[model samples]
Target: NYCTPYLGYPYYSSHDEMIHNLYHNDDCMPMRGFYRWHIQDPICFDEDLKVTIQQIGVGYRGLFERQDDVASVAYWYQAEPHNRFPKLPDKEERWPR
Candidate 1:
């Protein structure tokens, strides 16, 4: 998705005033930002769905598998009559520390 970096531009521009640069060290080498492609590329699934991401990088040596710490969150929309989501405990009970 690098080719279509979602900067919230009018078209396909790289004007990044929408998203904050979470990590951008070494001349945009090890760059990382919160990317959203739901508008541009919406995926449609019928029944079940699974999401996965791979850390791949390209450098002077070319494309290679990368090992990086990654964190992600996913949200989905369902049709009507869907099963209700289980209720969660209070914040104090959920995050007892």
Candidate 2:
């Protein structure tokens, strides 16, 4: 489960440096790195039972490179302004797979 601060949003450190260091020790082979963001909401059952439900989205990255290449790539998540939680279209909705 993901954790958010008591009063503010959470922040994650970029793993680019870690990946770069690993590549250097492994003879500089190309590598791909990935991470994901999850929205956690508390679910209440009766009066005392509770659990966290998680909604996972697309994978994101703070860094990506071809090892031998010089260019860098980064990515992150940005919530849509109008609809903080987007609703699935009726035709695309499903109960279970």
The TM-scores, one per candidate, come to 0.46, 0.21
lDDT of 2: 0.41
- Which residue pairs collide, candidate 1? none
Number of clashing pairs per prediction, in order: 0, 0
TM-score of 1: 0.46
Clashes of 1: 0
Per-residue lDDT over 1-97 for candidate 2, one digit per residue giving the tens place of the 0 to 100 score? 2443422323433344454566455554434333333335433243353333343434375444322322223333544674465677687465333
RMSD (Cα, Å) of model 2: 16.8
Worst window of 10 by summed lDDT in candidate 1: 24-33
Residue-level lDDT of model 1, residues 1-97, one tens digit each, is 2445654323333344445665532233233555466866878888688876887989899999988656666677767998898898878897525
Query: On a 0 to 100 scale, what is the lDDT of residue 48 in model 1?
Result: 81
| Displacement of the residue 62 alpha carbon in candidate 1, Å | 2.6
Q: Write down the TM-score for model 2.
A: 0.21
